[model samples]
Target: MTASRTTSAPSVDRLAPWGFAAFVEANTHDTAYRPPVVDGPVGPTIVRGGRELVNFASISFLDLERHLPVRRYFAEGALAHGLSTSGSRMTQGICRPHHVLEQTIARHTGKERAISFATGLLANIGFVHAMSSAAHFDAGIEVRNRDTVFVVDRDVHWSIWKGLEGLGYGRNVHAFRHNDVTDLARILGRDRSRKTVVIAESLYSADGTMGPIVEILDACDRHGAISMIDDANGFMVYGPENRPYAREAAAIRERADFVMVSLSKAVGLEGGAIAGPAAAVDAFELLSGTSMFTAAIQPPTAYAAERTIDVLAGTPEIVDDYLAHAARLRRQMHEAGTPTLPTESYMLSVPIGNDAVALQMREWFVEDGYLVPVFSYPAVARNQALLRLFPHAGHTEEQLDGFLRTLATYRQRLGL
Candidate 1:
């Protein structure tokens, strides 16, 4: 037998000098630093660096993450369902909690049916892919043509674009001016012969602006197009007195052919949902790529979300409190000469217009015991950086006052 020659494999350091590894290493310096580590559940207050910080970085608008009832539900759910689903819904992941949550979502959104996904981004991608695919059209819905066009809002979440791309309809996607109903109408008129889907977000995350959803839906109705609303940011924030589906535009919700929402935001849980006609939702459940591939949401999360909906429904005051706090923060910011971008949601965007200044302001806020995320390129257009603030119901008056005062000081010092 011949003796085998021993040889050492090349090290990662050698490979890191070229190709994708080198590119990533070189670009690491261009990215923002990792945020301070948190030690507990996210809420109005977060423990970081051994100190408590008033956290505006969280999207928990209702502060449900720290609510005793919500926490209790989470614990009970974990005890009952373990920690993981261990399989996709198409397999063995479907559970009683998931079905219950779907039913609650359907009832809450006034849709014929609802389906849940692992996350909001996945939900958007799956739903859009299903809606724009040939298989979905062949499943029974009448379509004018196989050539479908997606007229989407220019500022809709990237997930929407990704979904369209995944379905091979990227070239067919057209964008209207952000939140401009007239521009959307113009785009719809340009192609009345093609089967079109008009997409818009109920609340824009980056700019903290809301689209004219009702008008957009009306335009779709008139143009023989389907209207899809990504209500990820507005689902639990905007509505009659902060109640879900209670917006001044509530009457037009039914006019929208599809609605997608994120439970991680105001609901203080982790999951996404799509609400629509029973037939469409049923088809999406069977045909969407994510539905077939991604594991179902953890049972605990579904249980918590379902319980959250019940809590919100029973205690409307919670929603009212959140909206009230948001309004107060907006009002105070305006009074302090730091008005945010015009918005109707809980988020407030303070446009710094310069990336460097926004980052500096965020640092200053952190130093002053407040944590706020600075939105920069890709999240917003180039040079349109902003400090995004999420006002929550759990925030105390003192905390809000301190934050506003710090902001005012920073504005003066930085000449923003």
Candidate 2:
């Protein structure tokens, strides 16, 4: 009846379709399930499919809602300020709270000054863009014959890479293996005759590994290069007595030259800042194209950051509780013999092998009453996936235990 139809499939539209149909055919299917929803950062959340799950994927390490002071400040201040900063710092946007927050950040991080941005990516990108603009001229002229080489960790964030790619600084960018100080040294030695600028993160977001700040600083000093450390993942998590960066900061005063950090992680707020020597800060403010073009950070977020710092610095109880919970969770994971990365802090990476296993584990755990994010290639190693769980101050011991039990169930069921 259909005339024995044997028609070739329609050739996919190359320009309009953009290969989305092909991609969907390959990656997506009707069987795929969606992640659940949450009421807030706290545990005992309501998922999308009418199920309740304990949330552990939140970056809200400090349960902000429990902090009455932070809530009160935001409530009263956000209303009075009426939300946005309305403009960039260079234009009509500069406000009193912005300056106050910058000062607070500078003092907290032991740097001369800080320039706040909307997000961490922007801060890192903006810093690189700004620094390159300022430093390029110096390299081309004053530095004399010496080339300007940009040294970056292989795993440096996409934003940092983007900044480098956009710059016209020749093909002098060097990539060193992740956290390999020796490789970095070898690269620097090759460029001993030129001026270099190093860019790296303090705490790697994916694996929870810290960069060797002390060694990197030493290398920068030897090579006569300016170093920029994105402390976005470190900041309040590490204090002077416990962490190397804090100790190094105290010793050298202005050792790293440029430091960038985000307020979103441990600070429990939304903003990023560049902290550095007063001169570098000045140079960034004056010459940075990003700073010149983009609107300054909103006043409310700046105020929120200021309040967050005060809360974190003043209340050791919160940090202590968070650390204790994390340690307990770590011990439980170890006992369960789950393949979690060795971590000394709140960020925990539960390695789940390949993408399929990671996705299966995430789905199965959600069904058993827990929420953990599954991250795969392009963010981490190809085929190497993980369930990144962040322990927050708000979750109780019982809740954490529930999460562990659910994880164990999934771990066994999936034969992980």
Candidate 3:
């Protein structure tokens, strides 16, 4: 009939435009999306349903929000500065505080310069696109399509994948096995001639595992690749001495490279930054989408971020408390037969194996006065779900005891 002469347009339903909705609905059943309201701070707590519960889901590891001085600074900054920047950085948004924050981060991280973005995702996306789009051709020598390879860790954050995808060079992208330096070496060896960019995170969110940054950086150097790491979760925890990335920042600058981190996590603020050589920072200024399109984060956020950095630098007690709490929590969970990711980081994940068990455990824990969520496939390993928790600096030993006791009760009920 079509061959004879009839022409028919495709139906809107045939396009499957709402496929994402159905997919989300089907996969989101076993995950509890709890939005607990924070009443006040008392060492890892939130007032839920008229009761204060031990909160193990907050990302403020250094207790920026709970710190009275920091809160006061933020409030005063908000009063002094307006709510929004109201214009893009390239236009009128580059204020004194934004530059101050950048300089503070640069000084703290031992980098030549630092460029800030509105959010973590924007920072990742902007970094990748900026590297790709910057004018590297100075002598009529065009950078070919497949000449630059984007080497990524298999378990990198989705925002990174989105950034590479947005670059539209899927075929040029290669993935190394997660934290497998051998495979990374193999991939880099294969592309010895091309300019490669190794993309990895300092600490993976899904498994709460640390990347072999020193090893990866060595591999990157061996293959003539640029080592670009996302230090979103590791920045505060791994200050200068403890972190390979931070310790190697000067060397990275010597070799002409960088690493990006989010201010929202341990910084307890709103934004991200790429710290490295001034050349790359200049390139970011010229080509980063966040710089070109989005307005800088509010002056108040910048002020808060700067203050957070000041606290991290000035006081070691906060970090010490956080580390001690994480160690105790891990020990308690392991003793309760709920093993966490193989690291000493504050982000803890208690594996439950089954989604139903995970959901039950999460709900039971929350009901029994512990606020932790069961992170599922999208956020972590599929089919191996776990209850994700964040023990902050404000958390006390008694709070830890309460959480452990509640988890023990739920573990008994579920026979876990």
Candidate 4:
């Protein structure tokens, strides 16, 4: 072999920047345009950069984060158990509190068992990864990675897609139109040989719309497909009896083969859970890569979540009051001539259509001493930007009144 004429030194060519990273880097030079540094959530408002702004971005729908009892439970648990369990459930992350929380979730949802993950995103990704590959784990058929197909709603939460990221048959994934039972049936009908799993969110938080859950589940059953639901937005609010109070019932919780819940939302705490048949949930305990390799939730959060579930269980009237309050505010929005998407829950979006206009709307909110979340590209389709707002039960009368006035002013000036 001819002695390989090797170059002594490695070439030092700078790597080309990626699209979004380069875009973000170029834009960050504008100091005023960076993300707000929030101090923390206080009641219905947030303290940002030393100023308190009326907050519409918070998902603490029950306003339980400010509840003294919840706080006390969290504090007490932290003091007693220290902070983290410091290991994945496969290792030492397992703890008594985790078991209790899992039991609570299973009982509440009427599922056979439940699994807890560090976050809802993790829970979803892991559940999808593990459950889709599971053999007879309530799918009533054996499925390996190569034999399975995932049929997701077009607007299913991003984490579900992430879960299917590296699977062998991932390219086989098909998306049905959002909330379209006919479209879902067509897709489910196309392939019966492969094991199929249908995925959706019972509440599409971004659009402030409830999914056609009962219809979707009915279709899934008709086509011999299993269903997985992300109940992140509907939890603690949506239930059997016309939940989110008369808007729709979350029949998914009762009907889905699998369900994911984010404690970070209605519970106003940290952590996520996946509940299903005991065999399925147990298989994911080891098969769920996210939960197996990641540290379990902190003890304090588990304590807080448990307490919150109890408190919310006793107070179904709060859910009713919130929808009624949100309905009243939504009416005021119509009177203000602000163009809004048809929303069925306390969450609503003002369709802005253009990215720049939505960003400008955010600046206006900042200037008006309020903070609201806007969805643009990457969050939604291009030119389909919107200012998604939450009407919290905890917002004061003055705050609500001021928010409505600001929206009216913006509508008059920009016609958004």
Structure candidate 2, residue pairs in collision:
88-295, 88-296
Worst 10-residue lDDT window, candidate 4: 10-19
Q: Estimate, for each residue in 4-31, the C-alpha lDDT of model 4 and write its tens digit.
A: 8867553333334435446667773232
RMSD of each: 3.7, 7.0, 6.7, 5.6
Q: List, in order, the clash count of every candidate structure.
A: 2, 2, 0, 0
List runs of model 3 lying over 4 Å from the truth: 1-43, 48-52, 65-68, 134-146, 166-170, 240-256
Point out where model 2 deviates above 4 Å.
Answer: 1-17, 29-51, 134-147, 168-170, 240-254
lDDT of each: 0.80, 0.73, 0.75, 0.79
| Residue pairs with backbone overlap in model 4 | none
Q: In lDDT terms, how accurate is model 2?
A: 0.73
lDDT, model 4: 0.79
Tens digits of per-residue lDDT, candidate 1, 276-333, equal 9998898887666887788778888899999888777776677777777787889888
Model 2's TM-score against the true structure? 0.85
> Least lDDT summed over 10 consecutive residues: which range in candidate 3?
247-256
Better-scoring candidate (TM-score), 1 or 3: 1
lDDT of 1 at 51: 77
What digit string (tens of lDDT, one per residue) describes model 3 on residues 190-225? 774466799988778887877877788889877888
lDDT at 266, model 2 = 84
**Quick one: ranking by lDDT, best first?**
1, 4, 3, 2
Model 1 quality (TM-score): 0.88
